[model samples]
Target: MGSHIGGDELAVSNPTRAAQEISQTIFSLDLGGISTVILNGYDAIKECLYHQSEVFADRPSLPLFQKMTKMGGLLNCKYGSGWIEHRKLALNSFRYFGNGEKMFQRISEECMFFCDAIDMHKGKPFNPKHLVTNAVSNVTNLIIFGQRFTYDDRDFQHMIEIFSENVELAASAWAFLYNAFPWLEYLPFGKHQRLFRNATKVYDFLLQIIERFTQGRVQYSPRHYIDAYLDEMEQIANDKAASFSRENLIFSVGELIIAGTETTTNTLRWAMLYLALYPSIQEKVHREIDSVLNGRAPTMEDKQRMPYVEAVLHEVLRFCNIVPLGIFRATSQDAVVRGYTIPRGTMVITNLYSVHFDEKYWREPAVFCPERFLDNNGNFVRRDAFVPFSVGRRHCLGEQLARMEMFLFFTTLFQRFHLQFPQGSVPSLRSKLGMTLQPLPYSICAIRRQR
Candidate 1:
């Protein structure tokens, strides 16, 4: 059931195929000394990650991750008090700034700019990747820096390009090998080299911003994450062993910008692809928006009234299954899932693709049917198996902000324009894998809607 992928590795690219290869839901691969346990079903994943959260909450510090983050960031840090404190601080900051009316206003303001950029396409086919990325990154930028960048800003664009390139490279098998074998770093050339180069550039870029924020008397009223962090660091300066160090700030901001930009931006791109693929679905969503607000810009309040639109978004998140293999987690202590023993420090991969497409949990899991999320009464029904963001104490911290961006940007674009495959050209829903499952670059015509 476990076949060698190549060179001392056993692999499972497709969850359903992997399940067929091995009858059990929980199976392990001995990648040399590294043990990777794949949790392939919904029940098994929930049992370990959701139920035994503390036991399986730690992120494994692989070689590549160690080199990239140095265990300073919130996402890939080992499970301990330091991780907890960093996560708590980040959560508090996000809640303080990313909640209630102001949050939606900020998102909507960016959404307007996004719609305007799309309108400039003027019904011609064009790649929406940069436009979407720019808008999404701006939302996060505003939250993290108390400022936004112009779309034409050269420095900002280069930084984002490098961040995305590194993510794609890091997600490759080469990077996995780099993590498995640390000596690869000593070699003169490889994708790892390029990844390291890009990472340095991105970090240096971030460091410059950090220096600007930390320079001189900190008399500011804590404008953003940096300023707020400075205030916190100053308050805790008396403690020499504080977790809020300068290194953590750089890594934390890098992780926030990289993750925050990638996930929501890619999700919106998927939304665009799906809308173009299914014209009827697009029409229904447009109808719902038109009926709900009558041409007024969509607000968070309007989301509740538009069940079909909500259903579309839910389906998009579930269907796309962006983070197919959710971020790797490791067992902090010995743990058991579905009667299988998972030793301490074993690499744990929650197959989110399987959960989202599990036949037992979803009907016609392969089909792009928003109706699956809609009840017979036409009310939006939530499913427990929809774990695109994964579940547990360590799930995506930006879930609220991500959801806001998707809804605001998604509906606003559809409200103003109809996205369609250009002329007679057809685009596939096939995705290119990376740190995130990104839709292959495609073009769509955004014809303005006469509402």
Candidate 2:
């Protein structure tokens, strides 16, 4: 039996009912401002949820997510025809900005810098949070502004820290208050107000960059995302149908930076935890890397050859809950599921953790088994349950970039060194729950593997 989402009081009273089939009990009242929609035993079914996106495609009314997002800045935004227009342009923006070419090049270079920065902490258990955060943010910087920063760059690093701090508030108590009564933000002692101020700073920073980058030739001439967006704004200069203003461009780019950065960085951090905890698994991955390319850094093409290595990456994302409960989605219109008709504006969430760990779909779902991704024929076929990036129209825009960054950053570091938890400190699997369920912070030494 599964529980259904109702109003706030019902949710608060019936939260354990929402925990359903999960072994790790959820603290009631929705930490991140939406209750978990437990799927129970129905997860593997094709329409495990019906009217899923149709009944629930609106972004939740959380002031924290909404304000930070600037009301559906991109991914977690409400589902509407407006989304179609925005997503199409956003997808085009990815290409126009040379997302696959110059962007990937910047990603590779910045990721290499990440590896190098980690390499600097050689033989010392290092807290990689800030360096990794900066490294991840730089790829977005490259895409949005054609700029990349060293891990130690003060200006970018400060932006990264502030952004991280502000987003983390999404899972805090005040986030719920802000969502329930957005007016609370203006009240004294409200941290949400401070976050709004910081968000304004970030927005201003983006505006400044847009003001700087848009200088020179016709807006669309360069064919970059900003250029193209600016060109559209010029065409629709007076049209109400146009959301193609310079602020939109800045916010969209800023959205990419915020959404894209911490996730890949956190996943890398979790991968490190997995490596330290399971040295043999680490050895096997390194061995695969060694055998396939002989000390060369991994590439997307190399994934076809290194099956085990690919599986390791999958397992890392599966086990690491970077986006817990996935991004909130609400019903755009009334729709029925299992004979129950959820009304319009009904908020919905997919069971991201459940989908990853459902027993029917996985063998030893609780264990870190990379072999699950490989079939008897040993082909790395995509699993239906791999919805870490979400699915369908609302899928992540930075997925390809994330995959590429993870592969390069991860494989490069493994090529140069092996990591170990500090002396007498055991690797902890106990996750510190956050907006993403992060593994508790711990340091590890990257001892260079002798060639």
Candidate 3:
């Protein structure tokens, strides 16, 4: 009975319903000769992903996953010393460049460009989608390649479009089937082929940047992530066991760009949507920003004084639930989670949608209430179950950078303009699932505020 129900649940796209149908916290499915387990409930998820983190820290060998990530990349690599070494190297590099004053200044400048673009809408109803995407992706570009592109750059736009297209294809039902049955790859005529083609384009684009840096025509001062990685490779050049190979470098750059861009872009887009839908809440957030900054530019330090703004952002992440299914994981060995024995090499999926919207963890999960994240003194409160970035050892490496971008971009935008849906059109909270849960294509009007 558990197996049948679990199989049905896995077949569906809506994770919330799948969690509801399963009576047990952990449900196992025989997915095309692979043993897969779906973990629901906060406690069950915590145990599998957290308490027994090592037992479930590897990447699954799915066909679509292999094509999309190659499992050679930092994001989808198998659990082992190679993954650990690269992860640590990437984290240190991020730390070296991530929180520097120069980085923050760049983000602020990008936000200015973003606000300028929105202001171009002339108070008329226009879709802020591409504008936001350009600005958000520019920040990632700066981090990865130490450069930003003009919004009108056709090559850059095409690359982003390809990246976006691949993300949507990843969420399609075809991706699910391909992952389950690897034999589908040879049959031809499916999105799986397009995914590989796009992957090649993305890798080629990334490699050009690396080749430029390595060709010695450009001075290398270890300016950004790519340069820093090259420095590491030089230092360990003689070490045969070093994981800092050219292949890892290429994929690591891909990981940083893809991971950093889409999720942050989607979250900021959702921020505008929610603020537009709830004018009262929007006003409250605006008041907080206005009071704290006093018309000056926002700094990370100002985050403490603006509790309501922080709460609203947190609420947005919770409400949006971007990356609902999250990155898939595989077991390192046989493990017992919540009294269930999940075998070795099994695919493990922690149903984040179930945990985020579970009534047991939240008071009113469906309602967009930022107050739930605030305490009696109206201060921000952190909830353990608020795992938008996922939990445990294999959590998102970009968590800190993402938070910085979201808070800074969000506050700056709201500080400059009042976001609302276009005239005569209702704000639709509909989301189209992809690599992330993106807000459906919608137009929003940003009315500039008077200082």
lDDT string for model 1 (320-437, tens) is: 8888888899999998665567789988888787687777788777789999989999999999888888889899999988988888898888889988887888887678889799
Worst 10 residues of 3 by lDDT: 15-24
lDDT of 2: 0.69
Winner by lDDT between candidate 3 and candidate 2: 3
Top-down TM-score ranking: 1, 3, 2
State which candidate, 1 or 3, has the greater TM-score: 1
Model 1 worst lDDT run, 10 consecutive residues: 1-10
lDDT of 3: 0.82
Best by TM-score: 1
- RMSD in angstroms, candidate 1? 2.7
lDDT per residue, candidate 3, 145-190, as tens digits? 7778888888788888888888899878888888888788897689
lDDT (Cα atoms) of all candidates against the true structure? 0.83, 0.69, 0.82
- Per-candidate TM equals 0.94, 0.87, 0.94
Whose lDDT is greatest here?
A: 1
Off by over 4 Å in 2: 1-55, 65-72, 98-104
Give the distance in Å from residue 259's predicted Cα in candidate 1 to where it truly belongs: 1.6
Report residue 114 deviation for candidate 2 (angstroms). 2.0
